[model samples]
Target: MKLTLRTVGVFTLCLLLTACSLPRGAGIEQEITAGANDADADFAMYPVTRDFLPTLAEWPVVGEPELNWITASAGARTQIINPGDVVAITIWDSNDNSLLAAPGQRAVNLEEMRVAANGTIFMPYIGDTRISGLTPQAARARLQSELEAIVPSAQVQLAMAAGMHSSVDLVGGVNAPGTYPMPDQSYSVLSLISQGGGVSGALRNPQIRLMRHGQLYGTSIARLYSEPHLDTRLVGGDRVIVEEDRRYFLSLGAAGIQDQHAFPQDVVTALDAMSIIGGVSSSRADPEGILILREYPASALRTGQRGPRQERVVFTLDLTTSDGLFSARNFRIQSGDLVLATESPVSSVQTVFSLFGSAFGLVNAVTN
Candidate 1:
C-alpha cells in the first residue's frame, strides 16, 4: 500500500507515542521493592528504638519560656572557693607604723594578701587569723576589728583580686574554644560564645549545651536562635559546649548528582539538597519516578532483637507537572536520608547506542 506524506507523518508520531508508552516490566517494580527492602535491611542492622521520637516531640517549639541559669539544676553554677586566693584589702585612716614594726616590716608595700593553705593570713601583729568562707565585705569588717586594737580607727576594704570568682568555660565548635573569665559575674550563654570568637564556620545549627556539675542541664541552638529568651545566663564552672554540624544525608543511584552532603539547619529543603549534588543526570534519570529513603534516628524506631525499626515511605513525582510541585524540591531533608533516581528505558537505549558508536569509532581507527 502507498503511503502519503501526511499518513507517514501520522504513523511516525503514533510509533513514537507507542514506544514512550510501553508498559514497565514487573522487574522494574520488583527492583524498586527490592531496593526499598535492601535499604530497610541496611537500616535494620542498627539498633532502633522509639525513645528519640518522644524526645524530639518534647523539644520546645518556636516560642516558650526561657530557662533560668540559677533554677536549672542540671548545669548549676558552682563556685570553688579555695585557699591561696589573693584578696585585696583597703585600709583608710590607718598608718602602717604597726604593720611595719611587726613581722620585721615585711617589705612595707602590701597591696594584697594571699590566703595560706591553712585558711589563715598573718596581718602584722594580728598573728594567724582564719578568713575563709567570708565574703569580701565581711572579711574586711573582721580585719578592721582585729587591727583596731593596734591602730585606732582603722578602716578596711576587701575584694577578690585573682582567680575565677565567676566565669564559664566555652568549648567545642567555636572559633576559640576555651575558658572565659567573667569578671562582671553576669553574662548570658550567647555572650560567652561571642567572647570565644563565635561559632565555627563549618558548623550549622551549632548546638550549645549547659552542663552543671557534670550533668546535662539544657540544650539550645536552633531553638534558642528562634527564641532569644532561651539563651540562659552563664555561671562559674558552667560548661558551654558548642557541637559541630555533623548531620547529613546521602544521594546515590541514577541522580544527576551522587554524593553525601552535610545537612543544613533551617533553610535546607528537599529540593535545595538535590541541587547541591548537581540535580538529576538527565541522560540516565527517570524524571517521572524518583525515590527518597528517609532514615529516622534509631531511637525513633521500634526496638527489636537485631536492631531498631525503620519507617519507609515512597513517593513519586512527575517533572512534567506544574512548576509549583517542583518547588517542593526545597523541602528540608533529615539526617540519614537517601535520595535515589531511577533510569528510564529510553535513556538506557540511548546510552547503548552511544557506547556502540564509540566502539565502532575505535575499531575504524584501529583498522585505519
Candidate 2:
C-alpha cells in the first residue's frame, strides 16, 4: 500500500512538471507576448485604453482603400441639349410658295437631325445653327425666327431625344443595370439608382462608386440614405457602380467563432467586433487578454506621433476592467485585423488538477 501511494505521488509530480507542455487550443497571453519587450522585437505592442485612443487615431488608416466623395449640388431641372442629342423639327408655312413646305403641304417634318460635335445642326438654308446648349422650347423659338425670313408665316416645333453622350451608366449591383438617359441636369445618383432599381438586397452593406472622366468617388449606401444632402447630382457620361462591401476581418484561437467576418457597417469598434465574432469562449478565453493583430504597410511606419512604430502591431485589451471595456468600445477595428482571444493560464492548471484528482480516486478505490 505504501509503494502504490508513492507511485501515485510520483506520477502526479510528473504531470505538474510537464504541465507547461500540455496541449491547448490557444497560447496563453504571456506565451504570445513573451518576446515583445525584447529590443529587437519585430512587432510593437500597445495597451488599448482611454489614453492610447488619441494616439492610435493619429496613426494612418490601413487595410481599406482611401477614397473621396463629392457633395450634392443643385442643378436646373430642365433638359439641355448635348452634342449627341437627336432633334426633330416641324415647320408650318401658309405661303403657297414656301421654301420649307411644298405647294399642297402645310407642314414640313425634319426627322433624325443629330446634333454635331460642335453643338450645331445643319438646316437646308439656315446652315449650321448652334442648338446644343439650348432647351427644346428655346431652340424651337430660335429656329422659327430664322425660318420666318424665307417664309413670313413659318412656325417651328422641336423635340429632342437624349443620345449616348447625354446618358449615365448603371454598371452593377442594381436590379436593372444599363445606360439611362439623363432627363435633366437635376438627375441624381439616387434617381439613377431608382430608375435602374434600388441596390440589390443580397448585397451586404452596399457601397456606391462613381467614375467620372477617369476620377473615382466612393461612399456607402447607408450614409447616402441617411444624409439627403450627400445625394450628388449625376452628370452625363458618368459611370456609377454599386457593390457589396469587401472589407473583412478574421478571428482565431479561443474566440467563440473563428472565421472571417465582413464589416457590418462603416465603422466597427472592438466591442462591435467581439460581438460579431460571437465574443470569446467563456470557458477557455482569458477576458484580460483579447489581442488585435494588425499589419500596416512599410510606408505606414514612421518616427513620428502620427504613425505606427513598427509595421506589425498588437493591441491588447482587458475586458475585465472598466477602463478596458470603455476603451474597447471606442477602439475601431480596421479591415484585415485579427481578433485573437488568448487562453487563460489557470485553464491548464485546472486541467492538470483534474488528472491528479482521477489518480487520487483510483488509489482510494484500491485501498478500499
Candidate 3:
C-alpha cells in the first residue's frame, strides 16, 4: 500500500511540474496583462468604468473619416429654367398684319428653341432675353412683356423642358439608378431616393454620399431617417450614391465566435460589440478580464488629457461588476478594434486537476 501511494504521489508531482506547459486556447488574464505593470511597457492600460467614460469620450474620434452632412433647406416649389433647357413659344396675333405671324395666319409656333449658355433665347423682332433663373410661368410672362412693344395684341404661351443641367443622378445601391429630372425646385435627396424605389434592403447600414460641385458630403441612411432636417435638397447636376458600411472590428481569444463583425448601426457600443461577437465562451472566459485592443495614430498621442496616453491602448472591462456593465453600454467601439476575452486562470487549474486524476488512475492500474 505504501509503494502504491508513493507511485501515485510521484505521478501527480510530475504532472504539476509540467502543468505550465499545458495547451490553452487563450492566454490567462494575468499573463496577458503582466507586461502592463512594467514602467516602460509599450502599451497603456485603462480600466473601463463609469468614472473613466468621460475621459474616453474626450478622445478624438478614430477609425472613420470625419464626414460632414448638409441640412435640409426650403427651395422654390416650381421648376426654374436653366441654360440647357429647351423652350417652346407660341404667339397669337389678332392684327391684320403681324411681324411674328403671316398675314393670313393668326398664330406662329416657335419649337425646339434651346436656351443658350448666356441664359438667353433669340426671338423674332425682340433681342436675346435672359430667362435662366426664372420659373416657367415667370419666363412666359417676361416673353409676353417683351413682345407687347412690337405687337400689342400678341399673346405669348411658353413651355420649358428640363435638360442635363436640371437633373440629378442616382448612382448606385438603389433599385433604379439613373438620371432623374427635377420636376420642381423642392426635389430633395429623400425624394430622389423614393423615386429610385428606396435604398436596397440587402445593404447593411447603408451610407449616403452626395457629390455636388466637386465636393462630397456623406451620412448614414439611419441619420437621414431619424432627423428629417438632414434630408437635404438636391441641386441640379448632383450625383448621389448609396453604399454599405465597410467599418468592422475583430474578435479573438476566448470569444464565442472569433470573426470580423460589421457595424450594424451608426454607433456601436462596446456592449453592442459583445453581442455582435455572440458573447464570450462561458467555460473558458474570465468575466472580469474582457480586453479591447486599439491602435491610435501617432498624432493622437499629443500631450493632453483629450488624447490617448500611448499609440497602443488596452481597455479592460470587468463584466462581473455592475459599473463595468453599465459603462460598457455607453462605451463606443471604433473600427479595426480587437476584442479579446481572456481565459480564466481557474480553467487552467481545472485542466491540471483533471490530468492529475487520470494519472492517479493509471498508477492504480499498474499497482494492481
The candidate maximizing TM-score is 2
Candidate ranking under lDDT, highest first, comes to 2, 3, 1
* lDDT digits (tens) for residues 135-207 of candidate 1: 5656777888988888775566666753443457887988898877654434678788888888887776676
Arrange candidates by TM-score, descending.
Answer: 2, 3, 1
Instruction: Specify the poorest-scoring 10-residue window by lDDT in model 1.
Output: 44-53
Superior candidate under lDDT, 1 versus 3 = 3
Name the candidate, 1 or 2, with the larger TM-score value: 2
Q: Which stretches of candidate 2 lie over 4 Å from their true place?
A: 1-3
Provide the lDDT at 308 for model 2. 80
Q: What's the lDDT for all of these models?
A: 0.58, 0.90, 0.90
Q: What lDDT score goes with residue 358 in model 1?
A: 62
Model 2 lDDT tens row, 1-368: 44475787797888787776787778888989889989999999999999999998888889988889999999888998999889999887888988877779999899999999999999878989999888888898888888777677888889888887789999889999999989989999999999998999999999999999999999999999999999999888999999999999999999989999999899999999999999988889999999999999998896668788889999999999999999999999999999999999878888888878887787777777
Off by over 4 Å in 3: 1-6, 93-96, 102-109
Name the lDDT of candidate 2: 0.90
Quote each prediction's TM-score: 0.58, 0.96, 0.92
